[model samples]
Target chain A: MHEWALVDAVASAAETAAEQEKLKKVDAVVVVLGELQNVDRAAARRLFAELRKTKKKALHRARLEIRAEKAVFRCRACGKTFGLRDLNKLSHKESEAVHFLPEMAHVYTECPACASRDFEIARGRGIYVREIRGER
Target chain B: MTDPRVFSIGMRLSKVRRIIAVTGWKGGIGKSSIACALALALAKAGLKTGLLDADFTGASCHVILGARRSFPKEIEGLEPPLVAGVKFMSASFFSGGRAVALRGEEITQSLLEIFCVTQWRELDYLIIDLPPGISDASLDIIRLVPRAEMLVVTTPSVLAEETLRRSLKLFRAMRIPVAGTVMNMADRNGRAVGDKPLDRVPFDSGYEKTLGNPRALAASKLFKAVARLAAKLDAGMVRN
Candidate 1:
């Protein structure tokens, strides 16, 4: 699953942080999953668990905690803020396309209020490392 | 918050030997065509090559390579589909023939995501079809892929050459490596730029008909000129 790739990125970031912070053991890695990307949390967690086995000892003890963030968009034309549910429903194919590349939302969805494609993704884009707790 | 995708980009392209960012200063300079033809040429020469259509808004490498719009197989990461013996990846695969309207930041996000998720195999050459002009995609490639060598493309027109000079100045200022400049759609008496070796790709009138047909494209004179350019790049690689 593509979640495996995102989880791999999380692992890599945590490892880099550990090395930079001179961490002896990484205790927890907080990863934020944006709703727009629609990454499967269960798959990400499972993959992170499997990935830890092959990673260094510093990351082996690291706990992967994924937090969800709701998608928000703001229409640049009318300055109307909206959520994913507020917009017209996207087709299965369109949603899948957005899942692969979150920017595809611009192609598939538009401003619910003004119907302008020039809407900014105000928040909740994609996966990122929120925090990495470790024993330095 | 740290973007984890940044860390994985290096790991994703760790196996790629040479990353060539094929770019031009102006649109309609045949940058995409050169990138596609070069990728095909390299692959035909038995070098494992990959072509990433990084022009998110104006992705046409898929069309040039005659690749169908389909999702790449998910195997740990997205594996680029092999088109005409060249592994190809593009946003067109996801956009599905629709226009991808994205701002500069969105373009950067998409580019980073593509680099982070697309798992490139051990490639001798990875040719990236960058959008025309020096913009977010070009700068992002420079920052994200520091090892990338820029293969500037220009035409014989004075207007194209002026922009080419400006782009070359910027690349030089950034200390980016220039593989060489390609004078695409050159006239018979077109003079090469500066002291650089002549890498002129003559304008083939039949090039338009070869679009979306890889067989005809490979047999075209455009492909022949690009193949020669590919050979020169290969030799340079060996020397380096």
Candidate 2:
């Protein structure tokens, strides 16, 4: 369900990029999905393949590559940034909460060293289309 | 020149140049009302403006603008319907007065759907009415549109200030440009916390009764302040 939207948004963005670059065909689209959001690479690829077969044949020759990014957060108090791998130090309850409910991430997350509740999500919060490689 | 980095991975970029989100830390503080007024004010000022009700659960922009459910034409994709001088879209148009029961993936998908499919004309500003609280929907909006500026709404109560602080911190910590604060439902003692008051919208029964009328918005004090703020934003005179 979520992959369709991601694929649609990515495909549309590629269209605008394609038009601007005067490209006749798109070669490959690389999508880097954030761990924080709910999206699967297989689902995204399946959707992309289906979309290419539709009326938007401009993407017929294009290949889809989906990559995952590790979720990261930056502490506001100490200004230290850490990734999900650091969560091994967290209590099981806190880690589970973050893994299940992404919106409640702030509630579970705190600076490991300083125990600061204040932190800005430095990365892994947004889905990015890293590159749209096409042939002119 | 359009930067490739600015676009979301697969998002079809619309012509809407500037996107502004009106939000509050808590609910029932008139976030939707001010968002509507600001968009209407900009439209009234001869600028092409569009308003999207991102409050998927509580879609009331249609009611505020006195607009009925309209099926917007899909030129190449979905579009926000033009209503009451502001090109607007709300969940009510899709749900048909029924409650929308959407979970995590559904919510994110719906938002992404709107972003990818919506066809927008060239516009000066696009105002979004965000749901109260730091929900997943709101965070995605911030992440989805990285260039978007934020406008916070709050009442003058101490409780409101306490909650507003968290929101202010989130924006500040994330390095998002906060346009300014509008003290909605403020009295004489009502003050915007942390941030300077860009405008004060007092609780008025007169304004309440005329909410759905576009003609009445033209003379509203709220509209004047938002319009002035819009002018400042357009001129790049951001508040410190």
Candidate 3:
């Protein structure tokens, strides 16, 4: 999803949560995000801070939480689930061989068994509200 | 009324040379990449360059520069960290793995606070990677740095072109000179492939690549040409 669309989703989710909780104002918001989405966490927090302030509900103090998501990559041929951090260096080294991928999108790694540039990201593709706090 | 605080802050920021803004109305147009390329180019040309990633939702310069670990700190003022002799400040640095979505006066104040207290000791260039659209952050920086130059990034798509036209109006209003427009992701290499036109650069659209891939090698080469343009403009602020 585009960056702004994600922000809108988060804000809409927060409003829905607030309504469901029967709260007049939200005190804090917690976002759970996957690392692969290409979104900046810091910008989201600052934008949310300003967004909360200008709302009609009069939320005096509202904060946002950013939770990073780590993923596990499973080799399609070898059936090995390697932690992303362990495979990243090797993946970066092998990227030189496959120069056709766009600058923004990349092939993460090469399969050890098949030796093909194929791997599945088992985790790290969800962004949602993990928690929210309202005026008590 | 001209806010006295704004003036004080503007006075301080005026010290930095080559204030180039990377802006576009439509998103996903490689705004940050252009800023990174420009900043790196300025640095390579022996200038002290500072990069500011102003986009709250998609601050990618840190990732592109491979400096995702170092965060910006405030030692009396907001001091951006250095990478390859180029100083950079990004909303990503402040994000502790969260999002920063802001607009209007708050956005202006945050940018101003960064400009006011930065330990930017006599730099030659400051490249600002502005967010999408005509928000307060874009307005504030343009207003604050009236002499700064702008480089509008746009794709050949009609939506991006329309947006760029509107943004050009904003720059005109602020009296900021437009250095040029970058046609990012212009795939075909176009008519003057050998001559290398500044308006067009080819980019692969396939999804087979991963992070840190060097698909932009030609684009990186174009940075040298951009530096030539900067030098020709007499915007070379580097003392060395």
Candidate 4:
């Protein structure tokens, strides 16, 4: 749901040729995606597949690249930050596990400082276009 | 770069299904009606069909399908009802028409969740009846479903055509194939006057043609024709 803005960003950049003249021949567009956002990799590639069909000169040979960014979790009670892989050990999915703060079970995984369940999501951010390559 | 990692690690491997998003820039152009008719047609053709009413304002697919309430329980990844070979799902069944108050993003989220969490099993075609115009909700489906195709509906009126053209451009930009265009409210034999062809609409070429009052009967006939066209194309696409 939240990935549309990111999709729009990719489309907007490509439609306007934001950095076609930067440097070197371009053959692909690379995007960095966050685990927090549910970005469909196949859809992103398919969108570029359609985009390249028309702009054969530059994007014709270009492929859309997607790389995942790990999700970050934070504990509000003691300001703790941890990766989702670690949270999974505590029986929590990346997104759902973060919400289980000190409130639900204060003894489960307390804040290192005060051993509290209060927590908030931090670090693992949204999606963004990291690089664009084309014939310079 | 043909990244094998995307295919192996990142991409969600779901069944290959055709997603047909039926839309009309203007309301009351029989978008939902045509979608339902087409879904039923495909279902009868022995294709596993799923109809989704993306129109959050007026969820009428439920009424057309003769079903009520979005199925809360899934019978093994199949939440839609099995009626006459077609499976149906709609915001109407879930919200009871209360989805209108939801924000645009909320509607998109619900739409995605319906696709993600619902037990569609192995559907051959998923027909989505989108809300009016080229809004965020429409874009959400377009962006999410890489295989999503589009069908534009409009009345022959000039205003409707202009609006439908803008929508056509949107689909083109998204690279979604336009299956076909339908002109609703086409000239009918004077079915409105005296329940006979005698009350032919002025300038109507076919004076012998007589349609019925309330306009639905004539519109329904048009929908059936469009359904036949869709069925033909769908079958061909599958074969090829």
Question: Which candidate leads in TM-score?
Answer: 1
User: Which of candidates 3 and 4 is the stronger one according to TM-score?
Assistant: 3
Q: Whose TM-score is higher: candidate 1's or candidate 4's?
A: 1
lDDT of 3 by residue, A46-119 (tens): 66666565443724376777788775556655787655455445344233211111111123344444544345
Total backbone clashes of model 2?
4
Query: How do all the candidates rank in terms of TM-score, highest first?
Result: 1, 2, 3, 4
lDDT score, residue B55, model 4?
A: 72
The CA root-mean-square deviation of candidate 2, after full C-alpha superposition on the true structure, stands at 11.2
lDDT of 4 by residue, B89-199 (tens): 655544433324444644554554445434455788878898888786688776676567777767656677778667667666767776666565556521221111111
Candidate that beats the other on DockQ, 1 or 2, i.e. the better one = 1
Give the TM-score of chain B in candidate 1: 0.97
Superposed on all Cα atoms, model 3 deviates from the true structure by an RMSD in Å of: 14.6
lDDT of 2 by residue, B62-149 (tens): 8888876475554544567777678886656555454554444446756765665466668888898998888867888888887778
User: All models: lDDT?
Assistant: 0.90, 0.70, 0.59, 0.55
Give the lDDT ranking, best first: 1, 2, 3, 4
Tens-digit per-residue lDDT, A9-51, candidate 4:
4544553453446533457678776665445688667756664
- lDDT by residue (B111-223, candidate 1, tens digit) is 99999899896999999999988889999999999989999999988888888888878888889999989999999867766665558899999999999998999999999
Chain A of model 1 scored by TM-score = 0.96
For candidate 2 chain A, which ten residues in a row score worst on lDDT? A95-104
- Clash pairs of candidate 2? A9-B10, A9-B11, A10-B10, A129-B9
* Candidate 1 residue pairs in backbone clash: none
Query: Predicted candidate 1: interface RMSD?
Result: 0.6
